[model samples]
Target: MSANGLVQIEGLTPPGNAHRKTSKVMLLFPPEWVPTAPYLALPSLTAVLRQAGHEVVQKDINIEMYDLFFSDTFLFWISGRLDLQRRLLEERERRAALTDQETDQLALLREKCTVEVFDLAERAAEAKRIVRSQDFYDADKLEWALNIFREVMQYISAAYYPASLVFYPMESNLGYRPGVSREVFACLEDEQVNVYRDVCRQLVLPVVNREQPHVVGVSIGTQMQLLAGLTFCKMIKQAFPHIHVTVGGNVVTRLQEEWPTHPQFFNEIFDTAILYEGEHALLWLLEALAGGRPISSVPNLMYRGTVGVETNKEIYTEKTTALPLPDFDGLPLDQYFVPERILPYLATRGCYWGRCTFCDHGQGYFDQYRGVPAHQVIEQVLALRDKYHCRHFLFSDESYPPALFKKVSQLLVERNAGIKWTTLIRFEETLQDQELWYLAAKSGCCTLYYGMESANERVLNLMDKHAKKSVMRTNLMQASQAGIWNHVMAFYGFPGETRDEAEDTRRFILEHQPYIHSVELFYFVAYRHTPIVRSPEKFGITIHKQPEYDLPLDYYYTLNEPGGLSCLEAMEMAEQFYQQDFHPWAVRVNAREHVFLYISKFGTNRLPQIYAKPEDRLRGTDSVSGLVTWPVALGEGDGNKEDGPTMTRVVSHASGG
Candidate 1:
């Protein structure tokens, strides 16, 4: 058992053919996600299954893979793999000329091999310590630690050339298109570039072998995690043919229409897939697997029958008010890369404003929107806070509805919850009250992410956002003046949007740059299920679908008229905005959790020290200066002496201790 009484199962004796009342379920959260906190899906599913009197062992292999990457054992293993690859390339060169790519890779391998593995491993371990201890509050130490993580990822990426593995942003590509079914299947079997296969063998298979679970469910939440989640499923199915393997999450839900035709994916990769909300659907599936109910009666399930792939008739949507608090038992919460524990809680399901033209996030839900009342939200928040001994939270809501936003803020203030929180919100006119922002900040609202998709009023009308420039400006001004960090998300391209309209957005952001603390700019994607793609003619665009992308959720597109920016122009505009106008939001701390902690620690949004120095930006990378390859030594400071200004000491009574 762990220190907090959470069950820490290393292994279990193999289950015999004995009968039991409840099934043993092993829930796995795969890699390529943010490693700072536990995802809410596993805990949400685990809560229901355990409440139904079943056994569950929830493993977060995402954080484990990251944890493993920076360890002495894994680094030494990477060194050996690099050596083996270098020898193989030398042997190939003896017979034939090396390809350009192979020649460059061999040079990289030799250069990386020169770094002292023992020293790197020691620094890597220390980096983990720095992030998990009081040293994290020191910006200099924390920056050095984060650089070590990036360097370690660079070393590991050399083992699998052309994969382009990365540490942050979750953009690691294994040189395979996840949207193509054949390439997806091929990626699962590739021995050379598929790092997830090794991750599964090292960290996942042993637990499955020892626990002998009756069901293994993998949650593939994002496109980056699809390869890793499917790899774990395929390997589990191969090792134990009897264990029922299932996959679900937002990405899986997006591809629900394509799963029925992919029979090879149904039986070979995973036996079944749960769609939409999975709490009760998965529980009912367990009942079916246990012979208590007919398999056809289970809701939101897709499986292969004798006639081929079969989806159940009933689809399930969860009621937000009726659900239990997400149970985070059996997860190694302390192992996250933060000094304090930040728990994720969902107060609402689905986007409240479900009319964005370029969004497919609403496709994951069968229903539009539902939320718990403010009273119950506070009760649950207090319960979770006291029970876990944590004061920080990430409200994982799609968008904080205006009514609940005010009431929840009032309750947090009146009840004195002592909780620091952050969530995504819409720029509603109802939130125009400046006092509301202050109340929220007093109630410990450290950051708010807004989906200000476009500042052009005409473009906003086209996208169905309908947000007024006045309200958007007021929201940013009030929130920032109240000392809350404002993170604004905007994209450059939309169908029927002119170049002048896109420039309007750029000018507005630059004019209001002080209010917007952080920004995420991107070119719009023509998602497969969005309203724009459903009626391309209405948006004056044509979506070009590739035949190979049979399981596609997004597409390339072209404008039907000539006034708007082309796809290439949109890409160039976004790139230029970052290169020329993104200095104000270029943060040294990029991760959301890291930024949240910094905001909470200082109790303000104007964190000058956290912003990158002008010279640092000129260096063209976010790592510690001169530490990319090899450095003679790391600097030492409390971020006060010669590094920068001294940080205000705030007592963070968080749960990681």
Candidate 2:
């Protein structure tokens, strides 16, 4: 304790003392940069490069440009464009209108439009301040910020393609749908209304020019990031033709798997494209690039050759323990829309249950099952917590393994990691055990996103989720009762799924509203290399020739038995279920996991009443509550000490925890 009863808190400092280093490189997560947390790929890559004695810089343009986007300056440009268009429309209508009613309506329209534009501008300014300020986690203030984004996006969506401030990588003709390279170039050529293109010019170019990095690596994880990533590469290559550009991530790996089938578009955009785990491959590539060795020697990479695309076989590493700790040294971690920063840690690589028919997660990122030992994960978690002054963490794994997760949970209870965390989990026998769920909560497990693809057992089997409806429902309640935020990711429109089966999903949610905190439901799309597409006849569907898209697409057409909910029907059902009924609290699922964590920490939950203090919680089978067993000596005081393993700091509950 301080002699004066005042706590001394050290500020966050970057790891490297050197202001800048030669052999410079820059890694970026392109727009729309998620404002929730820093992307995991860049930091992991940064750590590897820094360990290799290369000075690597990291940037999340998603966040940087977002600060710029939500200002009066951006709004001013948008509002001016909106006003000009609307006034021109009004003039066109007035030229033909002579009636008093028409005149009144047009006059009223002008009045309303003026009021709305000014109101929208004010809202944008207000949101910019709150988000850029310290009070970002306040739901009310956050809502205002959201409103500003939504309004600005609405205008942009009208002028450009339909854009969104909600889900990231907002819909563009350039992204999501599959096409060849020429189409991609056409979209990039459009400078007037390409939102992501503008992001590249304004935000990315200047930074690249200043740094003049030797290599510029861009991370494209989701289908959404496809266009922006491609655009990012194009801009870098055009601006600094000498700078080597590499594109990689889950999305890149998947696209590379289908390389032979697709036209030769990738070679034009990036110097090299990395597939699957790029750790060893990238390290070798960088070494070779710097050493003037044969670039063809780099495995897991497709490089442009003098004659054709030169492909290399990827070297696989089953043991994940050898990788360096992910470094978040260069990001503005505090600026994410949360009171406390949420650090993303990868405890494992790939899924243990690699049998899911609908999922391609196992195809590359989680190709073979591997995980760091539980003790090591906890050790790293503790180290990261201490270093960053962050207690909340998000595990960026395909699904945390049952055995590993349980072991970590128990260790967390013992060590009191003093950390709240969330992860994607498959509903299995291990999780069904209520005791393990309780242990998870005590270890500070705040949210678990279960892939409840369907509540209908038949559809579940068809999708190869392999989870029984009854069992999953029971496990959900147990986890919920244990005081963990049990969120779900559900989907409809599997090959043989009927509307009735899809409705059963809704029935499950309604039946377990108390236990289930949130859900993300949608129609399932067939990605290339998924089981259903690989063996369409096995699922009683005919694979149709799909149109080539500018961006590599995840979905293709299927001539299936007409019993399932069509994609459009599924969208309608989601609108009815989430928007009409659930509204603000129960909303559409975005990539933001921090929102769930914020809700758990800052918002209300039933845990405090249900969970007993550690002491009262029984060590064995007794009438009590704890993670697994409430130790007899563990009272509120002891429980408090055991639960908070990290350094102590003063926390104010004035915001209503």
Q: Pick the candidate with the highest TM-score.
A: 1
Provide the TM-score for each candidate, comma-separated. Answer: 0.91, 0.79
Q: What C-alpha RMSD separates each model from the true structure?
A: 8.9, 13.1
lDDT for residue 508 in candidate 2, whole number 0-100: 86
Predicted candidate 1 versus true structure: per-residue lDDT over 539-578, tens digit per residue: 9998898999998868899998899988889878877876
**Candidate 2 stretches greater than 4 Å from native:** 1-22, 76-122, 129-137, 155-180, 257-268, 550-552, 556-594, 600-657
Q: Report the C-alpha displacement of residue 526, candidate 1, in angstroms.
A: 0.6
Q: What is the C-alpha lDDT of each candidate?
A: 0.79, 0.62
lDDT value, residue 141 of candidate 2: 61
Model 1, global lDDT: 0.79
For model 2, how does the per-residue alpha-carbon lDDT over 527-565 read when each residue is reduced to its tens digit? 666788789889877766545553444455554667667
What TM-score does structure 1 among the candidates reach?
0.91
